[model samples]
Target: MFNRIARFIPVLQWGRTYDRTAFSNDMIAALIVTIMLIPQSLAYAMLAGLPPEAGIYASIVPIILYAIFGTSRSLAVGPVAVVSLLTVSALAEVAEQGTAGYGVAALTLAFLSGAFLALTGILRLGFLANFLSHPVIAGFITASGILIAASQLKHILGIGAHGHTLPELLSSLASHLSDINGPTLVIGVAATAFLFWVRKGLKPLLKRLGAGATLADVATKAGPVFAVVATTLAVWVLNLDDLGVRIVGEVPQGLPPFTLPSLSMDLIRALWLPAVLISVIGFVESVSVAQTLAARKRQRIDPNQELIGLGAANLGAAFSGGFPVTGGFSRSVVNFDAGAETPAAGAFTALGLMLAAVALTPLVYYLPNATLAATIIVAVLGLVDLTILRKTWAYSRSDFMAVATTIALTLAFGVEIGVASGVVLSVALHLYKTSRPHVAEVGLVPGTQHFRNIHRHAVETVPEIVTLRVDQSLFFVNARFLEDLLQDRIRPGTDVKHVILMFSAVNEVDYSALESLEAINLRLKDMGIGLHLSEVKGPVMDRLKTSHLADALNGRIFLSQYDAWRALSRGGPSTDAA
Candidate 1:
């Protein structure tokens, strides 16, 4: 009971060792992350088509909840770029952007995603995440970054650009090019250029000016905050809003007001698939980040528990009028580098965001949409890894095909179709490969009791007894191949009367495989040829015993191929039931 409780709520394990040193480290890390996250939160929220304060709200309680339930000490949970984009895609389908219904739909998505994640964790079904191959994921993220950057071009051009795909966005922007607000475009372009410079140039310049690496790193991450301040100030001083500047305008102040997602069955049913997709993608991304960070410290993460943590965080986000979030690679790295000692850092960061929600909401009123767009563009652009395409092409052409297909589909269509198609292609690629497993003909190695692949080694072999080693789990797909290979080995009236199947790499034998084996036994029996088994795994032997296969196997089951070779070649009883 105690173990179960601790497993569900991981804070109990880490909280037991809380100390003043840990407190100090966590506090400092939290401070640095809070400073960095403020501008990011507001920007990401805007990107998700929510009120700016929703981003701050997202960072607040969700962090606290994740700290309480999460297993990782360094994983900082909040609104991240991919999850925010997913949120927009999910909500955009149900209601118009910026509508009350859209907001409700976003909250419901968070809740559903959180629930799905929590259920998977409880069932310990985290291994299902493996379905999304790394290459496919990389392709999806790269394409997603492109789409996100393209989508934000409306803010950059100061026009009413609207679309989900890049082409549509371009077309829409072109249609409204004549109506582009000059004032807004100037501010937007300037802020975007300044932020890009800050990200690329600031740290190097700061280090040359005697700034330490740690301080420079923090300041570099805080560059967007500088953009927000500068642009907001310019807008206010120059009365830029009066001249077509799209400011954030009024933001609701105070704590994140508690709310509940719409439970209407129609809404839930409509948003169900998107919620599940968001949950799965979010979980995969979170686990990957958590594992990488844990490796640096020689610590380990429980993927199952991570699901629970992220689930709780998303649930908090839903109820608090935020969107889905996960463990962001950049933020988690910053937390680790800033020397966070425990999950307390997340809680402290939450407190910092809460303070921002209460007091700093007014300061961002003059913040230009262009600056927020700039922040998102700068952040997600790093997610675009074109190197993956080259690497996949060199590594495996099949993987390259999958990666290329996923990227092209994502960009040409929208996010939903892209993700769905990517998953299907990944599964298809796996099945196509596994359906044609590598089968090797084996022979006796020189002066050894072991068998070796005939092609790879100079080994002794007998024409009468052919041995095959299958290097994959036996299932319906490749079951027929086994029989076909056996038939090719056997001649009409040859000396070959015994066939030995060496089951070394085969871990599982499904019903279809068993049926295939029975067919082999029956056919070999009709031909007066014996079908033998060597090195049958214990579990497989037990399973065979449960069926009539052992009784009607047509030949013997040897402990090893060497024993079978010794017994069969001795020319004992050549003719039996087989």
Candidate 2:
């Protein structure tokens, strides 16, 4: 019972081994991630069409909850660019942005997403995330990054624009070109260029300036804070606000307030699909990051437990006056690089963010929205990797199709449709491939137990015997294909009396496939040909034992393909063969 309970609450497992060394490592990681997440949280909240303070609120309680329940030592739970874009898209259909209803809907989205994740965890349905193929995911994220950067351009130009799709956003920006504020444009352009430089050049320059590697790395990571401070000072001192430079204004001071997501059926109905999409996408992204980081440390992550952890975190956000949150890729990488030893680092980071909410909210009052927009642009720009198109195209055309379709649909229609289309295409592609599984004819290599494909190798074959290798598991989807293939192979005057199936590659044989096999057996028996099975897997053999097909089989089940070859080549059963 204790072990099972600990599986659900991973903190119990790791806490038992906690030490001062762990605490020290976690504290250092927490400080770095906290510094990075402050501006990120605010920017993401703005992107989601919420108040800047809501982002900080999201970072606080959600991190604490994820620390308690999540399995990844370094995954930082908070508002991420893609999830925020999705949140805005989902809520836009139900409420206008920056209204009370919008804020309430954001909370409700978090609530519904949390509930869905928790339910999936409890039901052990975490494998459902596999429906979104890696290529499709990459495509969706790349398109979303492009969309996020384009959407933030309005803030940089100090103009009004709103849209979920790329074309819509571009069209809106085009119409508002004359409304761009000059001061905001200057701030936005300068900040964006500086951030790009900081990301690519600052670390090397700091090292050249005689700073140690650790100090240089930390300083480079803190570049956004530098931008925020410098830009805020410029706005305050130069009276840029008077020149129509939009500042963050007043962010609420204090810890996140306890709140409830509205429980209206109409609201639930409107947001449920989007909520589910957010939940799946968030879970996929979080698990991918967690698994990658854990692998580097020679650790393992339970996907179902991760679902529970993320579900708990989002529920915390919903009740704490914030929006939907997920494991952010950049922040998690920072935490890992900063030496996070356990999820405890996330908790400490939460504490640091809470203190910022209480004391540092005032400091951002003069921080221009252009600077925040610049931060978003720089961060998300890293996600736009068009090289995936070339890579996937070189690897597999079907994968390229899935990736291309996902990117195009996401850019043309919107996130919801793009992701939905990706899921459909992924499933469809998988079925299309598996339904026509590779079937090869094999014969024995001279003086060895090995078998090779007849067309590809110089091998000896018995004139009366036909050996076939099925390369995939037998299921309803490809059962008829197998039957037709066997019929074609054993055509009119083939001089074959024995048909041997090499089951070495087959992992499963479902009911429909079993029936197909039975039909094949009956047809072969009528043709005076014996149907034999060789090297059947233990579980498949066990399953066959429960079916009538095993009793009605026309020939013996051999322990090895060589054993079948020896016996069948002699045209009778061998007594030496068990």
Candidate 3:
């Protein structure tokens, strides 16, 4: 009973092992991530079309909850670029930007998304994330990066521009070109360039100057905070705000407040589609981060447990005056590099963010929105990896198709459309491939008790006995295909009286497939042929024994195909005569 309860809540597993060493490592990692997340959280909140402080609110409680419930040792949970873009996309249609209803709808999205993720975890439905393949995710991220950057261009230019897609954003930017504020442009351009340089060259340059690796890494992570501070101070000193530059003015100072997500039926109905999309996207992102970090430490992550952890994190965000969030790729990598020893690191990060909310909110009053936009641009630009398209295309055409379609749909229609289409496309491709599984005609390899596909090897065969290898499990999608295939191959009044099915690759037999097998067995029975199974896997054999197929057998299940052939063809070929 205790173990079962602990499985639902994972803090029990690591809580006992928490010690001073773990605490110190966590605190250091938390400090680095908190420094990085302060500006990022604020920028992502703006990206979601919410107030800047909402981002801070998101990072605070969500990190603590995920740390307690999540399985990854180093995964940092908060406003990721793609999830934020998706959040804005989902909420934009329901409520106008900057309205109370918009914030409420965003909160509601977090609630619905959290509930959905938690339900999936409870049901152990982590396999659902497999529908979004790595290539598809890469393409989607690259496309989302483009969209996020495009969306932020207005803030960088200090103009009022609004759009949902690439073309729309570009068109709006062009229409508002004359309204661009020069001071905002200068700050945005310079900060963006400097941040990019800091990411690409600053670490190596610091190392060359005799800085230790740890210090260099921390310096690199703090680059954005430096930019925010430097730019904020500049705007305050240079009076850039007087020149019509938009500033993150009057951010509330305090820890996150408790709030209830609106649960109106209409809100639920409206956000349902976006909620589902966010849930799937968030799960995939979280699991990938968990698996990668776990691999670094030679540990294994429970995908199902991770779902519960991320679900709990999102739920925490919803109730804590924030919007939906997920495991951030950059932040997780930073935590891993910074030597985070456990999920406790995330908890410590939450404490740091809480302190920032209380003591640091007033300082950002003069922080230019362009600086935030620059931070966002630099952050999301890392997510854009067009190289994946070329790599997948060169490796596999099928994967390339999935990636291309996801990218195109995401760029053209929006995130919700891209993710939805990617799922549908992936499922359809899987169904298509499974509908006509590999059916290999087999014969014995000379002097061996093994069967090989006839087309792939030179083999020996008895003319009267034919063996076939079914490469896929018996399922509803391809059950009839097998039936038709056997019918087309077997000739009436032929010398073949015995047929063996090599069940090496067959993993499952659903009801529809079972009925089809029965039909095949009865048809072969009428034709005076015996159907036998050889090399049936243990679990499949167990399932067969529970069914009536064994008792109603045309022949018998053999331990090996060679044994069946020898028993059935005993008189025809014998070593004793030799």
Most accurate candidate by TM-score: 2
Candidate 3 per-residue lDDT, tens place, 329-410, comes to 9999999998899988988888988999999999999999999999999888888999988998899888889889999999
Clashing residue pairs for model 3: none
Q: Write the per-residue lDDT of candidate 1 for residues 1-578, one digit (tens) a residue.
A: 87789878888888988999999999999989998898899889988889888898889888999998988889999988888887888788789977889888888999999999989998999998888899998999999999999988889778888888878988998999998888888877887888889878999999999999988988887888888898899999999999887889999889998879999999999988988888888888888988888888888889988898898999999999788888887789889999998889999999988888889888888989988998889889989998999999999999999999999988888888888888898888888888888888888998998899999999998877878888888899888888787778776787888888888787888888898899999988888889898888877877777777778888888878788877787764332211
Clash counts per candidate, in order, are 0, 0, 0
Worst 10 residues of 2 by lDDT: 569-578
Give the whole-model CA lDDT for all candidates, comma-separated: 0.87, 0.93, 0.88
Predicted model with the maximum lDDT: 2
Cα displacement (angstroms), candidate 3, residue 498, comes to: 4.3
Q: Could you tell me which 10 consecutive residues in candidate 1 have the lowest summed lDDT?
A: 569-578
State the displacement of the C-alpha of residue 530, model 3, in Å, after optimal TM-score superposition: 4.6
Note the residue pairs that clash in candidate 1. none
- Candidate 1's C-alpha runs over 4 A off are 488-495, 569-578
Q: Model 2, range 112-178, lDDT digits (tens) per residue?
A: 9999998999899999898788999999999999999999999999999878899999999999999
- Can you rank all candidates by lDDT, best first? 2, 3, 1
What is the alpha-carbon lDDT for the whole of candidate 3? 0.88
Candidate 3 regions exceeding 4 Å error are 1-5, 491-498, 522-530, 538-557, 567-578
What shift in Å separates residue 401 of candidate 2 from its native position after superposition? 1.0
